[model samples]
Target: LDFSIDELAGNVATGADTLSIALCKVSAPTKEPWLTLSYDEWICVLKGRVLVHHAEGTLEAKAGETIFVSKGERFRPEFPDAGTEYLPVCLPAFRPDRCIREDESDATVGQQVNDMHAKLQVAEVLYHMCSKEDWEKSKADNAAYFPPMFDKDGFTHATSVPSLLLTVANNFYQS
Candidate 1:
């Protein structure tokens, strides 16, 4: 590959799954295949230039310039100038699996994105470590569960990711 991408802020890089920032460096000429992205992309150029070909026309951006491409738009990115450096910011983060190529059915990706949105609407389970006695009390009262330290801390801690449950519990609730 003539290009290299380094993620600055993202799920794997900084755990910010809602957004992504990546530094892309193109050292040689290359024109990627047409594809429709599942997430919006905003690019800012630092060196050289970039040309994005889409159905409407071609969008060009030179050094010190920027370009915006909406998601679900069929487009191809070309780096005609060597040593091109740019930063791409994406909403909802950019994932390789969400990049649907022109050869691939657009409907399939649409449905997948839709299903993902639906799943998100289903609700996420928040993990809160507490004593079995406290848990039973909450279930019996059918109200919010408050820890004994609630009066001291005036706050309740919770995590949406299940993996962090143990780490948080060990660090804060270690007996």
Candidate 2:
């Protein structure tokens, strides 16, 4: 899959219960760190390079190299130059709610840090159903645009918990 450096947007390439593959792009330097609370991630560089700063130390990854960030490890990724593109394969998929931005207030971070363990223990797995054809299309195009209906409705649909996953998949997708 190919992408223009100007596209800073990211999208899920494909996913399953335990992991998800994502195509990520950064057009400009990031101003803050990003904390992934729910899953570990490995960023494989496809073009250009990025400096990954983690609790232990900082490392630079060039094209063809990769970096791993453990779950709960706060890290910041800085794109040294333009045309930075990478693939982040995340364990347990990626959810917006589980991703904490660095701009969050101190109080919020403190509370989340305090409740981290408890939250992790009871975290439920949510699922989103999609067609195999659509997944293949995304893989081929190197872009995963929102489902067509989402443009009309302005929202993506998802199953809230594991229990509903099978029923929803069976009802909507034949293959």
CA lDDT of every candidate:
0.76, 0.63
* Cα shift from native, residue 166, model 2 (Å): 8.7
- Please, what are the lDDT tens digits per residue for candidate 2 over residues 1-175? 1222221222222223446665566665442346645688888999888788777788999999999888888887767766688887767765555667665443333343234323333336556777788878988999965675686767665665567778866765465
Q: Which portions of model 1 miss their true places by more than 4 Å? A: 103-159, 162-175
Lowest summed lDDT window (length 10), candidate 1: 114-123
- Judged by TM-score, which candidate is best? 1
Q: How many Å off is the CA of 5 in candidate 2?
A: 11
* Root-mean-square deviation (CA) per prediction: 7.9, 15.2
TM-score of structure candidate 2 = 0.50
lDDT of 2 at 97: 55
User: After best superposition, candidate 2 residue 20: deviation in angstroms?
Assistant: 1.8
In model 2, pairs of residues that clash are: none
Clash number for candidate 2: 0
Q: Positional deviation of 141 in candidate 1, in angstroms?
A: 13
